[model samples]
Target: MPYKPQSEPGKTAYQPDVQITRLGEKIGDPVVPADFPHHILRFRNDRWDQSIGLHSLNDEEWLSHFGKFEPLADNLYPPLALRYHGHQFRQYNPEIGDGRGFLFAQMRDHEKRLMDLGTKGSGTTPWSRTGDGRLTLKGAVREILATEMLEALGVNTSKTFSVVETGEELSRGDEPSPTRSAVMTRLNHGHIRIGTFQRIAYEKNEALMLQLVEYCLEQYYGGVQTDDPAAELFAKVAQEVAKLAGAYMTAGFVHGVLNTDNINITGESFDYGPWRFTPYWEPGFTAAYFDHEGLYCFARQPEALHWNLAQLASALRLIADSEPLVAALEGFPKAYGTAFTQHFCWRLGVESRGFDEDRDLVVAAEKGLAEKTIQIDRFFFDWGRAENLAGLDENYAAFSEFSTLIADRERSRQPVSSYWQQSGPCSMHIEEVESIWDAIADDDNWKILSKKINDIRAMGIALRIG
Candidate 1:
């Protein structure tokens, strides 16, 4: 019998929307999935899968689709090697595109929002500039940890959908050679990046650029209701990206590579690599070691994101007027300020007052944190559970204003989970991540990684993070 999913009453059946190819063949090249030596199903995310019902699929079926790259019932027949040029480390690189990953499938989420199932380390493609298209098992593990911790902290991110260890040993410079290898699939809003527009703009195809802008509006920003849809879409994207950036700050996350290609048009954080959570609010702290300039450090993320938005606006200028796009770019600071206040308050388990008052509270917290060498996550976790800065008598005076600011503010309706009290905090510091990966490399032990995911999910559920 064909695999059939019974839909819940009044809910739509799980359907695949093959919309990417509709953008025309010029957008991407059809490619085949690599024939891997092994198809070991490692991880599967069944959250928000009410309609797709992945939790019901057995191991063999999971491997068939995600591992063997077999098509879902009515999804894409052949995956697409998406084409886009990016500014790698602020240097324009037109020669690079989806070197390893490809768009595997497209579907709608429970909220009727369009979602994509994309891959990394699935195979080589036309865009594989000069490398074997493979993701290290360690890289896959790190991404799982990064996405899990980010999601638990309420940052909008790509879900690490599945990981399958290919029976292949690969050599690499960054880490140990002859290490294990794996392929990962992520469920995200879309694979469309700021670089996507850069590519179209580079070709000087104004008509195609206009078409691409409209297509993005239709697919992602359908709520942009202004008569000038192009500029409004830019503004919408600006606000979303701003929210994401501030969320990263409040979450103590440093997205090591904030390049054009790494930035999603939807403003959701994805393509995690060399990401880290700060032990404290050190503005100059960097994530990627190669980022010698500290270009995408903790404090510079807003700047980096704003710069990327400028690039997007520059590309949009090929189709839309420059004035409105510039105006949209100008909204970044205000958007980021508003977002930081809200996210900071939410993380501390307090309700936000007006923007200025809320921002003042955040400033106080950061100012105190700056003086002390404390982990930001601990402060957040402690505040969430106890609703007071009870410990750290030595640092009490400096940080007490944080308590004062929230004295008049009521707590949020969301209850802090007991997990916050039990588990210290779920942080993906490089040391801890390496420890987990070490266990896998040395002993092939996955229990730690599995428990960490559960613990992160438990924290998310405990906080009722929506």
Candidate 2:
């Protein structure tokens, strides 16, 4: 079926829910939104709104709900600040929670799966220690670019649903003297982080731990029929997290922060802080400037996420036996290997022959990338057209296996669209991101950003990925 943009969106089909509050005060705290002097709507994602049935909202209603923090119909009134503890940089930190954000609403997507609408830069809550609970406009812009590019690359990431500029000057030492402020709404699967489980276990609340596990099984992992729901849920989360790490690797994304709190149970990547796309297949690429030791570097992402999953296993032991959780942990490397092959094959627009051949294809592509240092996106784009392949020659045997493996497979999508026929692929390098922000900051020009998004969406459509 051909994909069609909705001529009319945001209909009354919105199916809202408030299941997060069912965990009661044990999971979160009710909090008020920050009052800002002004509210200027920056961006609203109409494509995603159609999924949640909020596409028809005019600018005023959009601002009223997202900017002013007005509650959605049948949604949480005073939004709840979720509580959790995380391992930051391999060290336990009980002080972390939803310090600057809170769950604003819940609804079902077009697939009828439960989804969360959360906020960033909302206001300070009990968890906001010392620092001001605010997000800079540049930060929001960076997130927009990151999520857009990641989504186009077939990564399971959060959508920056709405961004509204709030009139305020926030002081920060990182960027400039006083940066502009904004509030952003993130739409994703759920906010149940591995840290959520860790907090329950840290408190030695066995009943709450059981409750959390049961809720996860019922809502997130409903297909698991095992008697040991906790164990099965841990295994399912492990699989999903492995797939997420695989996506990051294939997308050449460095999350920069993969703490336990940042690893959601659904494996949906969110909270884009200091993220970077590798300029090429630079294995040691680090996104965050503060990562002195490169703790969460590009190649070490799987390790970082595995460590986080271990923390979740440590927490799940309150209800599940240690053996099953350990077994699940032991399977991370295998699961990651399978997912990386599948994702790599998909991105290359090639049909998979099997696990062995797919893995071989991936190894060949990596060798090809390493030998010539071909930029990741350009390699993918050039692969679609044999005429544009600059480095894949029989004279160089490093990419010969790659050429042979690719020759046996056929294109995944027939009659490939012209998006791949362009002179270049849509990419989100740090320089391009900074240039987009510079446009907005210098001339208040949003046209360049808008065009980039259109180009990315066109590429995504051409890629024909879910």
Candidate 3:
């Protein structure tokens, strides 16, 4: 049966207030492809749709908006390919923007929080200077896995809204050549990047820079209040990004690309290009194959994010006073440390006693993992269980201090299940991902991939993560 909308179309709380694209030359406008064949709906996140009030979109409507890149009614039309410049691998690049993707639409979710539907492999844009604007099916699958796994791990991340297979062949140096093509949409809080500010700063347009800062504050930082709104916005973003950096550390995930362009103002992790989760706690782990210098390595992620936040501060300086922006940047290290400790405790399913105890627990946990050479997921899975941690070793003495705290905490709304008692926690390792793709690529089978997603979702529920 063809999927049908559970609610009325165009009856949504659709707010098409697009501020970035409204700035004419500040960003580039791009149109959707007219000839690409929209073949099949490979994936759709109806669970996420419920939160955004987009569950009413039927399959045909979904294909139209996601696969064919049709503009949402009363939303952003003639989707804009955002323009920005960034430092790639610590080297400044002047000519990089949305090459194969564009901002498709924006809306207010049920909570009235602003959300954007950004596309990948939608088609060629003005930014696609010397390359074909295309995305491989494998790449789309990887993104879906990355977002799902990260979300399950309680990391603030963009949700893979939809993935549609576009019937076309594409050649690539990475993965198999003449691979199938796909178009994907990610539902994120906002698309405003640090590079957005950097572009105006490069052009020396203080007026536009200030305007951009104001737009960001109105959209993302609506709750923030201060004498200097721009400086307050910078401080808020720095704190959010610092928390994000801490989440990455606790989750043992490397985003691979920490470029300024990839760092969004909302500090929610998006753009999963070459992301990977470490099998073990290894600081020097690098996800991208081309990252020969390990510039954005696992341990160095905090450093890279701090650097990106600094760039944002520099851009903000074109409008705001330098002292306040510098002051905002100075808070990153402390903010990251605090967030890391909290997130680490959350992963262990223990209530943190306090900052000092949490810090000591995190230190002990890391030392335990290193000494035992334990699998990251296994460690979390075992530690998350109260029963498993009831009898702790001397190595886990610090964690044992939280035993009473864990027992005293409120029980989860959901009942405990056998999923947590499994041999190992759900993980999206490279080998498993490639194996799932091999089934689809070689035999046209999606069973394994689908099952894996379901299993991952189950793990999220078992772990009490939203």
> For residues 156-201, what per-residue lDDT tens digits would candidate 3 score against the true structure?
8899999999999999987768899998999999888888888888
Q: Which ten contiguous residues of candidate 2 have the minimum total lDDT?
A: 1-10
- What's the residue-level lDDT of 158 in candidate 3? 91
CA lDDT of 49 in candidate 1?
46
Better of 2 and 3 by lDDT: 2
Off by over 4 Å in 2: 1-12, 387-398
Q: Candidate 1: lDDT of 304? A: 97
Instruction: Candidate 3: give the clashing pairs.
Output: none
TM-score of 1: 0.95
Ranking of predictions according to lDDT = 2, 1, 3
lDDT of each: 0.83, 0.85, 0.80
Off by over 4 Å in 1: 1-12, 390-392, 414-416
Candidate 1: tens digits of C-alpha lDDT, residues 1-466: 1111112213346778888877788889999999999988788776644444455668898899889899988888789999999898899999888999899988876667788999999989999978899999989999999988888787888889999999999999987799899999998888999999999999988877767777778889875476776797899899889989888998899999999999999999999888888888899999998999999999999999999999999988887899999988897999889887888887777777768888899899888889865578777776676646565456456787878777677777455456755757766788988889998999989999999988888877765541
- Each prediction's TM-score against the native? 0.95, 0.95, 0.91
* Candidate 2 C-alpha lDDT tens digits along 86-198: 99988899998998999999988777778899999998999999878899999998898888888877788889999999989999887886888999999988999999999
